[model samples]
Target: LLQGGDLSCVIRERQNSNKLFSEVQVLEWFIQLLLGVRYLHKRLVLHRDLKASNIFLKDGTLKIVVIVPGDFGVSRILLGALDFASTFTGTPHYMSPEVFTCSGYNSKSDIWSLGCVLYEICALDLAFDARSWVKLLMKIVHGPSPSLPESFSEELNHILHRMLNKDPMVRPSAAEILKLPYVAENVKVRSLFILTSL
Candidate 1:
């Protein structure tokens, strides 16, 4: 367990945090998560379930949050380098269309789920919602993709749209995502912080 706690606790600390993430703050969180995902991918692991509750944070110094993903109950390590994985796993709200349809999938599925997580972080609401399971599934498979508020920066909106692309092939790989302007810009800012601190 993370010494600080999970991100859900972080979200809970500020009642309206869901509605109030600055672009820089959200980009930093996304960069941290993408780095973690890149580590998992390099090791051929797939964190099938990636949501707010599943992400843990360091215990001390709550000012600068550190995300440590937890809950590996449903995660899997691929036996081969092909990257394809079985379907029908992961939480429905975060599940990609391929998972719902039992179509062949791969690590990109995790990207889809992460997109949903990022969206929730920014919007303070799940990307997909419905009164029932069937409707939820339908919404995920056929409903229009979720959109961010107009207040979000154009770059942030662009990256999120790519992340949430319905077509797995179209979504950026973790590595590719790490290279996006938004992510790269923050990485430099973080590096500057480290260097200056030293």
Candidate 2:
């Protein structure tokens, strides 16, 4: 059983308490998220409805936190490497541009959702907000990508931008994102931190 509850709950509690996550904490969660998504993609699974609320955290031994992606109600399994899902599914706030456009989407769509979750983690708010689904879709399709808070590192900002890119082709895949220097370094650092803590 997961002890820490969903990420959205954690973020909400922190926000209510006027406390924000440190950069290290955010990076650790983000890297864990990417690794989880990478594993899903490698297995030909598409978690179409990835959001902060769907990710759970468990307290591990030695105070380490383990992140798990859940809520697979809308997930699909691709039959081949080039396969894509056309049905519209996923939370509106975290939906990718292609998903909003009714175009076919692949694993990259999940990456876009990951970007939205990451933004929410940093800002404690949705990246795109509107009174109606129509306006929300318009903002997602034509609006400028939301910027990370000034306090976040520029490297993170860059990574978020890449994931939120309007063109799915331009967005980096989960594996590609994990290979990024910043993400890779964080993975290594997080590993060392966990190891030393134990």
Candidate 3:
């Protein structure tokens, strides 16, 4: 959704779940992702790298093709990665700690990042902005994240909290998140609440 040109960091941050981006706008984008994940999980395709900046919005009101194919980060040609579950990869703001510890990771790791994405958009701030490899790794391993804003809907807060849980195996998959009531029936309404608050 950003206009083309080499992006300026300031402009990038402003677009990153900033208060001006409207929660509904964020939610709408998320809903599309959820649907995409649903189809992807069904195909046994896991995106591994998902973040606010990577997710794109075209019509601002489109859906049905939710997954935004062709950009699953480093997995584009591998069909999946070797040692896919353990390679420490992905962006810091949304990457799971396991992705860095060299512990190897998987689709579940992507779900965790998805949680960060949800949290970032609602807060209109990146979860963790690290400056170096060590710092980024340290943050993912032990940093406190951007907390759920006090004004958020209870359902949105709940969904985000659930996603952020540290155990990769325990984290819900996109398919699973989609089935949750918050994602299923009320993204529009709860998301609308976020938009109005801003």
Whole-model Cα lDDT per candidate? 0.77, 0.85, 0.64
What digit string (tens of lDDT, one per residue) describes model 3 on residues 98-190?
A: 776667676777678778777766666666777787897787678765567777677777777667766677788787787787667756675
Q: lDDT tens digits, residues 51-126, model 2?
A: 9888878772112122224533688888886998999887899999999888899999999999999999898889
TM-score of each: 0.87, 0.90, 0.72
lDDT, model 1: 0.77
Candidate 1 Cα errors over 4 Å, as ranges: 1-3, 16-19, 59-72
Off by over 4 Å in 2: 1-3, 60-72
Model 3 deviation from native, Cα RMSD in Å: 6.1
Q: Rank the candidates by lDDT, best first.
A: 2, 1, 3
What range of 10 consecutive residues in model 3 has the weakest lDDT sum?
Answer: 2-11
Superposition error at 168 for model 1 (Å): 0.4
Specify the poorest-scoring 10-residue window by lDDT in model 2: 60-69
- Candidate with the larger lDDT of 2 and 3: 2
